[model samples]
Target: MPAERVCAVIPAAGRGTRLGLGIPKIMVEIADGVTVWHVLHERLRPLVEHIHVVMSPEGEGPFRALAAGRIESGAVSVSVQGRPTGMGGAIFGAAPHWDAHGTILVVWGDQAGLSPVTAGRVVEAHEKGLTIPLVPMPDPYVEYELDDDGTLLRVRQSREGDECRPGGLSDVGVFCLSTEGLHEAWTRYLDEAAPGARTGEVNFLPFLPYLSRERGWPLTVVPVTDPDEARGVNTADDLAFARRAHQRWAR
Candidate 1:
């Protein structure tokens, strides 16, 4: 088989109401005039030939203005999500732009402390299969259950009164998906998703178990060495914390 082409997909369409920021959370500046989106793109650029950014319709103009050079140079392409369809929709919106025979690296646009090396590690470890970057979590926000040999068994959501496991791995929103399996899973999700669901969105997590159990897709988990690299900016406090983490990682 020919070398597998890899593309990076960034979902930045969320309104981020909790942050109460006037702008999209991904546009929030983390460093001197450098926003989270810039950091994510800079990190993924070295690992993939093309980067597709999914932004809200209203955020397109600002994002384009911010990434003008990259867009003009064909290094980055932006797609507008007509409405909020959650992360799953954002990924699907950019689906047509992906290479049919290649693999995709789905990284959240608000991810901070992401370095080129870290992004490269995920791609290198994929080995032309499915891979999800995981980080040790003090509390199990969202946990991935794995087999003894490291094969992904299923994903478990945190419940009230649950204690954190000693070495729990949380999904860091970084996924390396094979084009074939992605299409299969995405199609199944759209077909089965109910209208006006609880969150009014299709979360990608719930499908992992279905894919592994029903579809028989081999899933691999790659642990992220620096937990900071998997950190995402949500609330004001999260932004502050991520900024500090980025500064430390940059040094």
Candidate 2:
């Protein structure tokens, strides 16, 4: 059979609360005189067929700026989810429109860290099966901020995902949700889940562990050897550090 179609879903709706930049972290300037994700999308387009961006309800302007003077007048599409709603909600908002038989790539638009080669590597892994981009956080000297049991929890406030793999899988926001798994999760969530009791948000990561258990989905972790190729923008400080790292690595 031919190669599977790659339809990408980029979640760019986060509030960037830690940045205190009064703007979404995705809009932050990096080298090349463009916002960070701009560079990412430039490298990513050649490898994928369609690109869908999920942004905050109030994010149309900044998101549009990221695509300035591009030939992708029709190739890119943007959708806004009403809530700061978790990453899960953004994907759900766009589910009805996603390609059912194609592999769906989920990436954080704020992560301007992938080399074109590394981006191709993710697509290669996706073609194989369920996969996640793993990376050793650059601040190695500081020691990871882990749980009491020494697991690297992605977030402190909502630390819940379990370590199905031994070393506690490192999930860089770049994820490859297989078509089968994506459809399975979408169907189950739409059929069984009630709106969130409080913020009415949906959490997508829950489905990863659940589908892995329920449908024998093989969730595999593909660790990125170069840490700089997998960093994410969360704060102004992180941007500064990554810029330095990017400059060093780019050359």
Candidate 3:
């Protein structure tokens, strides 16, 4: 079979209020002069044809400055989301800038620990359709409710105050989305859904179960060996942990 045409989208519009960072979370330095932008871009470069980063209007300038070399080379591009609409909105905001028909590898910008090998697994698993990498986490930020046969029944967002089951399978913030008819599906989802009760935003995770059970899209969940790969830098403590973990991993 021909190699699957792949592209990547990084929803980086968040202002990092929870992180108490003056800059966008993606721009916060993890290593010496290395931000999450550099980390995610380096890991994804080998697997994707191009990368599109969805930034807030104010974030676009700093991000572009940080990615100047790639921007000039056409390997990276930026799109601005006009408002704080959440992940699904950020993804949808970049729709006009990239190849709409190809499989989209969506990775949250804060997922700095994402390794090239795990990203490759996500790309490889795309042959099974919509692919998601899941990690076993003690206190999952997001949980996947599955049936006996391992079909994903629902996604519970603990951050949004959803009461999730104990010791659940959490997403590692990586997904290979099959984009065929995706716009229509998103439009339908927009019409049928309401903003999250706690966050008050149109979330993207729920769309996975929507695609699986409602739209009949085949969903494949790839189990991640290292739970640390699910590390996301959402707060100051998270950043501190990532710095320490990164140093340890580098040795």
Give the per-residue lDDT of model 1 (tens digit) for 1-251. 22238888889988878788878887998878978887887777777878889989889999899999999999888999998867777887778888564888888877876667767778888765578878887766677777776566666654322344756888677888888767767788678854333455567776776676667777776767666665678778889998887787669
lDDT of each candidate versus the true structure:
0.76, 0.65, 0.85
TM-score of each: 0.88, 0.77, 0.95
List candidate 3 segments past 4 Å from native: 1-4
**TM-score of candidate 2 against the unseen true structure:** 0.77
Candidate 1 deviation (Cα RMSD): 2.8
lDDT of model 1 at residue 108? 85
What's the lDDT for residue 88 in model 3? Answer: 93
Please list all clashing residue pairs in model 2, or write none if there are none: none
Candidate 3, 1-251: lDDT as tens digits: 12337779999988989988779888999889988888898888888888989998899999899999999999888999898888998898788865554788999989988888899888877774588999888877789987776667899997788987778899888988867788789999999887888999879998888888788788888889788888899877889988887788679
Name the lDDT of candidate 2: 0.65
* Model 1, CA-based lDDT: 0.76
Q: Candidate 2 lDDT, tens digit per residue, 175-242?
A: 77667556656668666654544446455654554555555566555667776564678767778876
- Candidate with top TM-score is 3
Output the TM-score of candidate 3: 0.95
Misplaced by over 4 Å in model 1 are 1-4, 149-151, 158-167, 193-198
Worst lDDT run of 10 residues, candidate 2, spans 154-163
Residue 234 error for model 3, in Å?
Answer: 1.0
| Greater-lDDT candidate between 1 and 3 | 3
